[model samples]
Target: MSTHPHAPQSHVHDTLVVGGGPGGLTAAIYLRRFTRDVALVDKGNSRLRLIPVSHNYPGFPEGVPGTTLLGNLTAQLERYGGTVTHGEILGLRIEDGVFVADCLPEGAPDDARREIRAHTVLLATGVADAGLPIEMWREAIAFGSVRLCPVCDGFDVMDKHIAVATSEVNPVGHALFMRTFSAEVTLFERMSPTALTDDDRRRLAAAGVRLVDSPLLSVTLDASMKPVLHTEDGQEHGADVFYPMLGENARSGLAAKLGAETAQCEEIVVDVHGATSVPGLYAIGDVTVGLNQIAVATGQAARAATHIHNRLPPALRTASTRPPSPGTTM
Candidate 1:
């Protein structure tokens, strides 16, 4: 973790990026390359930190751990004079033509608050998924006994027994979606009141997806280290991978606070350039609507940074190497 305390003054930045995950780090690199003064504030709870391995990302045939990938991105950004500061952004507001945010520094004194002012702000705050119901959840994921994000790891579970569990009111759609990847798919509708609607039953029958009305009891590794799901009815279902269909909670509170439009899922609505309804306020990565993946985040970051760079006036076009000193307001 990193910390920076403000000396009772506002620090002006060309762009202030929130969330130090893939999107924010990539945006920092791009902005620094464009000679813009950019700062990334991260609370260090990135979903990427939980990934044991990613098999779909390009340039890594052998697969790469999430932490490793994040480190690589951080190094790349630092090489270009961009760095991530660990802080929790407590408030965000726009005044004049600049965005101002208040932050609490990590590992610093309780009274050491920091204020950041920027011409532009990018919210790359990612989302979090409800993990599987297992005591050794992290170990299970590391051993491929549990998995999430069918879009990212569906290939690994193809043609294998897949168990999906979700807490959504309507878990049928997620169950049906997983059927495309494997025929041996079982959906555990544990939290749904009306677990299956007429349409849901019809679709599940058509897709050959087995429906388990019983709630999950426990999950543990079997002899071969495979995930074994035990149900309330004392029935045990063994699978190659136990996938949780639990929906993700997007970290879009700041965006909503700024009156930005968001989808029902709380994902920020953004244009192709990652600009939200508010000018100079942008969003990217899992925080925005689209495929929630690292590659997608980096692309959105690139586009947003470029758009911000091009939108600046000639006088402010040059990259800002130094941040505003204490007491300096934008």
Candidate 2:
């Protein structure tokens, strides 16, 4: 937790990056190399463990998992020269020439919070899965069954029986991607197919996707940790792989509250430099409108770091010198 309350934060350093996913870590890496005093705060992205392997990312011909990618990025950040604080940012604001943030550690913080007054702030708050939490969902996750964003984990479903549980008429590109892995793909839309357009219907039909238009009532986990979803229309379906093609609301509430432009899913509209509507508050990753992937997030953060470094105020901005002392002349 960090912030700057009163006078301009001349000592709070160069930047404070929030959310240590791909984006935040990349931002820190670039900022540290440029000699900026940057700190990273993460709420521990839980989705890391679920991504079995990711092939879309370049440099890894065999592909890598979300957890492994994040771990390597963390090491790079620490090695290059960035401090990491495990916490959640509660508040943020901009002063004369610095950005201020108020935060506290996880669990309980009776205001054990600290203030980080810096020259810039990069908000890489990625997205959280948007859905009604069914009790059995947790059980499904542990057994590596119910997958989110199949594009990120669908490869593991090769030659296996898989079902898509969602509320979209066609579930868009998901049914297509899943079909490549498992021919036994069952597309379950918790709604009526009539809600879909003629083109949507044609595309799905051409794709040979089986559509199940029924409301999902509940999820029952079997002994093997497989999910047996009971539909409201009294249909029972089971699959070796349960893919929730359901959509999600981005983690942009904080940015929105600060007057950053937002749209559906709270995806903030950020420029190429990660600059938002506000001057000091910036964004990266799926929380913004650009492509939502590990590589996209990492690239956006790197570019944001370069942009922020170039825009730092003269006071908080530092060169290759020792940290300025309290009474030291500027």
Candidate 3:
């Protein structure tokens, strides 16, 4: 929330991190600690902000709210003299061996655009879930009735009646995965049964997951604030928790515009160090092809920051921290 002014046009940072999520903030911290000039731009739409509470992230035994975690990361970055500009990057391109980002400041006039220059750019823009059919989906998530990642919150819904609803014809994987946490698990297909082969049906039956061919008409909260699914056949089913397995859309447009290779799903393709196919460009977190978890994103940020630091020229050192010559006395 630090309202620092944006860097002047002539000020080209050593690295420019796009997005203000955990991954981007962590990288800014690392790069600043290395004494490298860093700039970060965020549109303020990270998916982490929607998570009510996370029990999977390590070191927090009591669990932490997503907003609290994000706030802490932002504070830590500011403490290290790093600032995040509130803007949407309209386009990214390389010019004269440097990255130029065309950005639209948040709430600015449509024609008022500015360009940010940097030697290297890190795209930490995360993905967005398709979400549920409920109008108050975010409120449902806060109420712990509508879950997103089963891998992240499955333990919390243990022994509860779980419902997995997907538009895909065969979404047995998520239903089966939820079955591991609860004995009463059901899979509701929102599409007409066409691609659901007999083998798929057999697997669900073997796993004790009830398969519902009727599409979910709507989902409403019951008296207890639990999700109650109304199917096409006028049958209503209530569950302790509901998961919409529609899919996710990765925010890799900026990287794609820079000629960076991306997966079929539009996730940025990255190397072991999180470097993209384009030189001086890198991507990490849900934007990249990997597990979309906060822990994984933070770890990827560390790798990319270290690699960028080593690849760039050594930062200027002050006399106090300068190394002594072999024959020189301290």
Candidate number with greatest lDDT: 3
Candidate 3 structure quality by residue, lDDT tens digits, 123-194: 999987675578588898898998889999999999999999854534678898888899999988777654
Better of 1 and 3 by TM-score: 3
Model 3 segments more than 4 A misplaced:
1-5, 167-170, 321-330
Give residue 299's error in model 1 in angstroms.
0.9
lDDT of each: 0.83, 0.74, 0.87
lDDT of 1 by residue, 215-237 (tens): 88678888788988888889988
lDDT (Cα, tens digit) per residue for candidate 2, span 49-154? 5566677788998988778988898788778756567788888877775677777777755567767677677888888876744447865775678777666667
Candidate 2: residue pairs that collide: 1-103, 2-101, 2-114, 2-115, 2-116, 3-115, 3-116
Model 2 regions lying over 4 Å from their true place? 1-10, 61-65, 132-139, 167-170, 192-194, 313-330
Give per-model TM-scores: 0.88, 0.83, 0.93
Off by over 4 Å in 1: 1-10, 166-170, 315-330
Task: Please name the candidate that would achieve the greatest TM-score relative to the true structure.
Answer: 3
